[model samples]
Structure formats: structure tokens, C-alpha cells
Target: MFFVDTIELSGLGNRSYLAGGARTAVAVDPPRDIDQVLAAAARRGVRISHVVETHLHNDYVSGGLELARISGAVYLVPAAAHVSFERTAVHDGDTVEIDAGLTLRALATPGHTPHHTSYILEDSGMAVAVFTGGSLLIGTVGRPDLVEPRLTKQLARAQHASVHRLAAELADDTTVLPTHGFGSFCSSAQAAGTATTIGREKEVNDALVRDVDTFVADLLAGLEDIPAYYAHMGPVNAAGPAPVDLTPPALADAEDIAARLAAGEWVVDLRSRVAFAEGHLAGSYNFDADGQFATYLAWLVPWGKPVTLLAGSPEQLAAAQRELTRVGIDRPAAAAVGGPASWIREGEEPASFRRATFADLADRRASGDVVVLDVRRDSERADGHVEGSVHIPIHTLHRRLDEVPAGEVWVHCAGGMRAAIAASLLDAAGREVVAVDDGFRSAEEAGLTECGSHGDGGPTA
Candidate 1:
């Protein structure tokens, strides 16, 4: 068996795969794009025989169907995915034999989502590895808050039970591969920068501590807010998303942008909001293309209108394009050839959006009673946050103006884009506002303490 592991690195997170015995591979929790999986298999001279979805993911759209279509691979999920996918739904004790000596068994591991499952692979009776999606993370268990808040306790119980099951069933030598890594919001405890053995995790991961109740309580503590688009992605993944049309027209110039703008295509700058505001082609809507780029574009940018991108570089253009396609936004009508800096140099000035870095935000947070506005979704705020930060998503800030403080308001998100927009909006609303440049990262790094709360509010919108 030529055991080959495929890893997908996207914006600080990763996905994993296992291939053995020539041209037969099992992909675990592939990202929304299946092309990369296919390419990886081809490079290793193997065929993808199966795509194993660790669970019905809420973070990014799943690419199981896409793999099935492109590679004729079998789609595998938990037996209770609750939807029709032409897959071999597996449950506890079910096993798929890829060869005479290799077997992958499905273990019913709930608590992330109701139907989450983990796969334990064995070769010649020796436990090779396990693919644990949300059920169990490297250092922490998957957050129970993905489901309804009222059921958090129920889910937490199930999660604890599932952890106990895995800890008993899998041996200490079993290698561990998780679906997400450090940057992912899916798991509260970040990955240990990389993959680790089950033994290593058992020795260190807090979720697997001696006491179940204590582990459960500690695991649920200080979970940051879930992204606003998390709810929107579940259905799309359940019902297989369509591929993005990458066949865009010829590279566009300034006139092309103007023409598209005249035709009602909003100029969405796929740059940082600060970069966009600092100097971008005038009339472009600031669409921060850093993280969750596709989700925001799909929700905010109106469909059926032509669009153009202002990428920071060629690499960024490709990333922006790929993310746009994950949500079914195939191709922009055109792209600015000169890039953002060129436009700035050419006198196509942008509105500079100033921001305060993590240190500055911390200073304001400590020195006085500056209004702190958290623009993340309600579920995210359920986790820890800057003590007493007002909760309001960027979308609803305008209507709920009365809720924000009249003092110097400092706005922030998990990162920075939404906070910049929130601050911009507050500034426009004639309230004193300063956007936190580093946002949550800065706050956490500065040793700012966060209060604990399981989310009680339902999904925001």
C-alpha cells in the first residue's frame, strides 16, 4: 500500500486525505473545490475511490458530490445526513474494504452536527489512522453551538458521549487527521499548528480530560461568535453546490470597469477594506476578499449584474475568483488589469478608511469607557468577547443605532473588515467611531479576558 496523504491549505486551515494500494484513495472532508483533490490524486498516480465527508460541515460548503461527479468516487456520509445524496450512508460497525487487507470503518460520532461521523482506518489489524471531523478536534471538541442554542446541552452531552466512545474504540497509536486547523471557526480549540496522534491529543487536549462534565463545561467556554454565513452554507452543501464558471472573458481595462459600472455591475474590490478605502478605483464597493470572501459576495453583491475585481495581485485575483465560485458566483464580467496600486498611482484615488491596530484598540478598551461594538453574529458573541462589547452585526447597525454608545465607539469583528464597515457606517451616522485594525486577534493576544456564555439567541437572520 502506497499510503499517501493529501492536505489542502486554505487561508490558515487544512483538510486531509489517505490513499493506499495504488489508484485507490479516500478523501476526508474535502473543501468546496474538488479539482485540487483530483489533481493531487493524479499527481500521486492514484484514483480517488471514495470521498468521506467527516460530517455535514457548517463552516465551508462540502465538495463530496463534486468529487463523485468528477472522479466517479463513492460519496460516504453518516447514515443520518437527513437528505438524499447518492452515497453509501454508513453507521457504527459499518466498514468499507478498499483492498484485501485495508478497511475503513465508520464510527457514529455526533455532537458537531447531529449526524457527524469519524472514520478509523486499519491495515492488517493495526489501527492506521482516524479522520475526525467536528466530532473531535486536536485540542478541543467541536462546538455544540452549531445547532440550536436550546439544544446545546443535549448536543454537549452527545459530544461528550462521542468523545468517550472514540477514546475507547481507537488505540493510542492511531494517527489523527482532522477536517479543520487553526484558522477554522468550526472547532473552539485551535489545532496544535499541525496534526497529532490520538495518544498525543489524549495527553493534552482539554476535551478528553478525566472528568466528562468538567471537560464539557471547559470545552464550551469562550467560543467566539460563529460566522453570519454559517447557516447559509449548510443547505448548499447538503444539496451539492454548482461549479463556478471560470471561463471569464478577456482581461478587462479601466474602460471595461466603467462600462460594467454603467451597466449596473457593482465594482467589488476584492481587497482589504482598509486597502480599498486607502485608494481604489472610485465607485467600487468594498468587498473584503480576505476570509469568507465568497459568502459575503453572494449575500451582498446582487446577482445578474456584471462585476469586476480589483485584486491586489495576480495571486489574490485567483483566490478572489475561487472563493466567489464556491458560492456559485462563477466569473466576473472582467478584472482590472492594472491592479489597485496602479490605479492609485494613476490618480484613481480611493476613500482612505483608517483603522486602529490591536494595541490601539486595547488602549481604548482599557483607558476609558469607549463604546465597544461587536459586529459578529449573535452565535459568535455567545463565546467570549471583550467584556461589555455591544452586539450588532454590520447589516443591522443602521436600524439599531440607538443601541450603540454615543461615546467614542470602537467597532470590531472576529478580524477587521466588518468592523471597518461598521465604523465607517457609524462615522457616516455622525457617531464617533474607530475601526479596530487587528480586531479579535489583537484583543486575545493582548491578554484581554473574555466572559463565557453559550449562545441562546437563534441564528441571526
Candidate 2:
């Protein structure tokens, strides 16, 4: 019997898979961190015999080469990828036999990238599952704009054809597992759920339901700004990602930490939003290690700039480092694990800002003393934001700070997580900031007027 197990990289909202018959298995789209994949294979009592990549990923570095080298598995990549590494290049209609009854067939599925492919797993002549890496997702398809902008429209059209081809070729009962759309920015639309079957996606997927021209238009229209780090991911993955160094980063003393801050280096606070808002280093920015740490941190920090992590404990520091490395932010200059009290004991003054509920902000708004700043994406703001709130998506806020009017800024996002990050940025820029750490629905309930047409509020990460 053939089985498949999911290995989720929750920090990036992506999933990798382990599938095969009892004695041997295949890994699909493994992340840069390969230990988890190894553990999953061991738990299943199967040795990974092959590692296949659906495409050159644009969101995070892949560990396929390293994983294959370490395990002596055959590394398989699409023939059209033109990668610089050694691999058995696969083509459309190609098949690889894993064990007696299990085989993987490659299908050319281009859209997310110029040379993307999907795999169909068959057990004893019966189709069991299709691993649609970035092509066909749960409710949507992968955004085509991650590649060259000129190719986006062409890729979107190709994406439509790819899904149609999958629906036509695969059996209705074949499981449809995808890698890029679970909440990641790579998705063209928000996923309806975590899992779906080929038949169900054919019946309900927007890309599959619409005509080719309409699908292309809608897909292009739905795409948001791609993260800055994405431009670097393809090259790194193509060149081959180095095995991740998970050793605890060197600890920096308070003086070194303060000096880095003084030299205009990023000192990121990875604690919770509440903890960060209560007390943090004066210039340190809050990115909450609990949230989408890799995506947002990489998005905000300048590429190749040195970073120092500040966490509440050794575990937090390690977790933060793991997430950062997945996106190619490999070695931090240094990390300090502790609280504001430690910095205070070292003669460093900590900074803090006020946190307000939607109700409190509403009261302040009534007094005409607060300037409401909505830091959600344009798509999110279009889905019923508080009336009269100044709009600036969190990702673009760093470059667009000059556009913000001078005032006591009251910041908010869909949830408090992003608001805290925004508040920290504004605070670091010397603005009087109040983080409105509350749900968007609460603003409506508190009698704040809601405006804008409703549509999918897609992921802020």
C-alpha cells in the first residue's frame, strides 16, 4: 500500500510531502530544513529513495539537493529548469518506479514558473494522488507574477490550461495536494481549506471554473506586491542551497547590541507583540517570532544587512533563527535572549508605546485627537476598513513613511500581530504611536463606520 505524510512549514505557510510504498518513499518540495523531513521518513519506517522538485521555488530556499545528497536519493528536477546542479532531468510523461507497485509520473504544468511540473503517484496502476506544487492549489492557483513581470499574463493563461489538464487526466478520487497556497503570498487567492481532491477542485476552483482570458485577468489582478527577498530566492535555490546551520547564534553583550543599534543595524524583537510593546530596546523593531517571522522580517529588512535577534528565551531565539534561515537569512550577527529588565540592568533605557482597543481608539476618534492608520494590504482595506483611516500596507510602510501625516498615530491591522509590528516601525521612526491591538470585527461592533466593498481579504504575509 502507498501512503503520503505531510510535513508543514507553518512559518512560511507551505507544505512538503513524503510518499511511497512501505519500504521506500519520495520527498516532494522539501524546505531548506531537512531534519524534519528525515524524521518524518524515519517515523514512517521508509527510506527516501527520490527527491523531486515541482519547480524552482520563489518564496523560500529548497533543500532538495542537500536532502538527496545526504540520503543517497536520486534528485529529480524538471528538464526545463536549467539548474546548475546535477540531477536526473524529467520531462512530461516520464515515469520513475519507486517500488513494486508504486510509480511517480511527471506532468508538465507551467504557470507559477516557466518550467513547473506536477507529479501523479500511482499504486499498482491505480492513481492515488497528485502533488501540484504551485500549480493547482486548494481553492486557487499559484500567483504567476513571482517570475518575470512580462511573463505573468502568459503564465496565468498557462496555469489555467495546466489545471484543466490535471482535471482531465487524473481520476476523480485522486488526492490533490499542493505546496504554495495554504496562506503563503505565492497564492493567487486565499485557500478555502487545507486539503482537496482533484474532482472537488475541478468543481470549485476559480481558475478551473473561469474561461482562459478571465482566469488570467483575475489572477493578475489578485496578486499583491511580492516580497523583496523573493528576487534572491530563485538564484539561491538554482545555485543549490547550503545545508542550514541551526547552531545557536553567538550571544551579544548589551554593549554590542546597543552599538549595532547605534550603527543603524536591525535589532529585531522576536517576543510576543504584547511583550514587545510593554518594553523593548529603543530602536529595536518588533516582528513577533510567533507570527510569519520569516516573510515579514525578510520583507522589511534591507537585503544582506546584518541583523541581531532579541528574544525572551533561548527557545525563542532558536525558533526565530530556524525560521529566518528558511528564507536565506542564514547567520544573524548575534542574538540576545532575555527581557527588557536585563537591558535596563545594563544601563540601557527601554522604550514602550500605548496599546489601545478598538473601543478606546473610537473614543479617541470621537475627541478628534487620534489619526487612524490602517496598515493592512490594499485588498484587506477594501474589505470594510474603518472609515477615514489612512491606508498603508505594512510591507510598504518602511519606504512610504514620509507620506504619513504628523500626529498621534493609531495603527491597526486585521489582527493585532501586524499592528504591533507597524507600531514598532513607527515608534522607531520617532512617531507617537498607539497600537490598536484588536480584531477588525471589533471595530464594527464598537460602532466604528465600515467602508469599502467586500472581497477576499487574502493573507497579509
Candidate 3:
């Protein structure tokens, strides 16, 4: 019997699959850290015979090349992908045989990227599952705008055709497994369902239910802030990412931390937002581990800038390092474990900012002047937000500081984590800031927001 195991990279909001018979398997769209893939294969008692990528991902560094090399498997990449590495280039209609009467068939589905493909896993020639990577998501198709801006419209049209083709060819019972859509920015829009099938998709998937023009228009319009770090992912994947290094960086002391900060390097604290707001090194920024640490940290920090990680414990530091490595922030310049006290000299007091709720924001607004900064994405802000708050997505907040009107800044997001990150940046820049440590829903309940609107944008952080 063929078995399929999913490797969920929850931090990245992507999943890699390992599937085959009891003895042999194939891994699809693995992440940069292949150790988890290796462990899953070990648990399944299967030998990985093929490692394949559905596309050159624009989200995380691909571990397919290295995994194939390590497992002694044939690395299959789409033929149209412009890559410098040697591999068994696959095309539409190409099939890879597996043990025990199983097979994987490649079908061209270019929408998310120029060469995106979906792989159908078959048992005895009966279609059972299709690995629709970045093409057919749980309820929507992957975004078509990641490639070239000039090719976006063309890609949207292509994306529409691709999902339709899959729906037409695949059996209604075919299990539709996708790599994007589960909170990954690769999705054209947010997808909430835990599981979905091709048959179920026909009833709900916009690409399948709507006309090409309508689907394209809505998809394009809903596209929000593309993470700044995405610019590096495609190139890294095409060039074949180097093996990940999870070795802990050398320790940093107060002197080294001070010097790094003085030199303008990022000193990130991977603590809880509440703890960070209570106390943190003056120049150190909080891209707390309790949030989408990798996405936001990589999104805001300028590429190639050295970063020193500080965490409450060694475990937190190591965990943050693993997440960062997946996004190509391969090494921490230095790392420190312990609280703010350990990070500063005896006489030095850690920097801090006030933590307030939406109710507090309302109370403070009534008594004194404050600038309300909403650091949610444009897509989220559109769903309804604080009526007149300064809107700047957290990813763009670093460069758009000047746009924030002057005053004691009270920042908030769909949740408090992103707001804490924004508050840290604003705090470090000498602005009086208060992190709204509450849900956006409370903003309306507390009369701080009037989103005469449809729904909340879920928890973006």
C-alpha cells in the first residue's frame, strides 16, 4: 500500500510531502532544512528515490537539490526552470515509477510561476492524489504576481487556465494537496480550510467557479504586500541553495552587543511581545519568536545586514535560528541567551514601552493627543480598520517612518505581535509608542474602529 506523509513547515506556511510504497518514496517540494524530511522518511521506513520541486519557489530556499544529493535520489526539476544545477529535467506527461505499482505523473500548471507544475501520485494507474504545489491551493490558486510585474496579467490568465485544466482532468475524488494557501503569502488570498478535494473545489474555488476575467480581476485586486525578502528566494532556489548550517553562532556579551548595535547591525530579541515590551536592550529590536519571526524579520531588515539574536533561553535562540535559516538568513552574526539584565551592564536600564489595549487607546485618546498607527497589510486595512489611523504595513514601516505623523504613537495590528515589532522600531527611533496588546475586534467593540465592513483579516501575525 502507498502511504503519504506530510511535512508541515508551519513557520513558513508550506508543506512538503513524502509518499510511495512501504519501501520506496519520493519527496516533493522539500524545505531548506531537509533533516525533517530525512527523519520522516526514516519513520516511514522508506528509501527516498526521487526528490522533485513543483517550481522554483519564491518563498523559501528549496532543499530538493541537497536532499536528492544526500539521499542518492534522482532530482527532478521542471524543464523550463532556468537553473544552474544539473538535474533530471521533467516535463508535462513525464512519469516517474515507484515501487508497488505506484507512479507520479507531472502535469504542467504554470500560474504561480512561469514553470509551475503539479504531480499526480497514482496507485496502480488509479488517480488518488495530486500534489498541486503553488498552483491549486486548498480553496484558491497561488498568486500569479510573484514573477515579473510585466508578466503578471499574462500569468493570471495562465493561472486561471491551469486550475481549470486540473479540475477537468483529475477525478472528482482525487485528493487535492497544495503547498501554498495555508497562511503562506504564496497564496493569492488567505485560505482557511484544513483539507480540500478537487470535487469540493469546483463548488468554492474562485478560479473554477468564476469566469476567467472575474477571477483574474479579483485575484489581482486582493494581492497585498509581497514580503521584501521574496526578492531573494527565487534566485537562491535557482542557484541551488547551499546546505543549511544550524550550528549555533558564537556567544555575544554586553560589549559585543553594544558594538553591533553601534555599527547599525540588527540585534533581534526573540522573546514574547509582552516580555519585550516590559524590558529589552535599548538598540535591540524585537522580532519575537512568538510571532511570524522569519517572515517579518527578513521582510524588514535590509538584506545582507548582520543580525545578532537574543533570546530568553538557548532553546528559543536555536529555534529562531532554524526558522531564519529556512529563509536564507543562514547564520546569526552572534547570539545571546538570558534576559535583558544579562544583555546590559549593572547600571544600565533596558529600554521599555507601555503596553495598552484598545480600551486603553480609547481612554488615552480622550485625555491626550496620540497618533494611532495601524501596521496591518493593505489587504487587511481594506477589510476595515481604525477610521483615521496612519496605515503602514509592518514590512514597510522601517522605510516609511517619516510618513507617520508626529505624536505619542499608538500602534496595533490584527493581533498584538506585529504591533509590538512596530512599537519596537518606533521606540528605537525615539518616538513615544504604545503597543495595543489586544485583538482588532476589540478595537471596534471599544469604539476605536468603525469597520462598517464584512470581516476581520484573521490574525496576520
Q: Candidates' TM-scores?
A: 0.77, 0.97, 0.98
C-alpha local distance difference test of each model: 0.70, 0.89, 0.90
- The regions of model 2 sitting more than 4 angstroms off are 453-461
Name the Cα RMSD for model 3: 1.1
Residue 257, candidate 2: alpha-carbon lDDT:
84
Worst 10 residues of 1 by lDDT: 452-461
Model 2: worst 10 consecutive residues (lDDT sum):
452-461
RMSD values for the candidates in order, in angstroms, are: 5.7, 1.4, 1.1
Name the candidate that leads on TM-score: 3
Per-residue lDDT of 77-164 in model 3, one digit per residue for the tens?
9999999999999999999997789999999999899899899999999999999999999888899999999999999999999999
Please provide, for model 2 over 1-461, each residue's C-alpha lDDT reduced to its tens digit, 9 standing for 90 to 100. 88899998888989999998889999999999899999999998999999999999999999999999999999999999978889999999999988779999999999999899999999997889999999999989998888898998899899999999999999888899999877788888768888899889988998778999887877777788898999999999999888899998888878888889889899999999888888888888999888897899998899999999988999889888989989999999998888876654365577999999989988988888668899888778777888878999888898899888889999998879889999999999999999988877777777875775334433432
Q: Mind sharing the TM-score for model 2? A: 0.97
- Candidate that would win on lDDT: 3
Weakest 10 consecutive residues of candidate 3 by summed lDDT: 451-460
In model 3, pairs of residues that clash are none
Q: In model 2, state the lDDT of residue 355.
A: 96
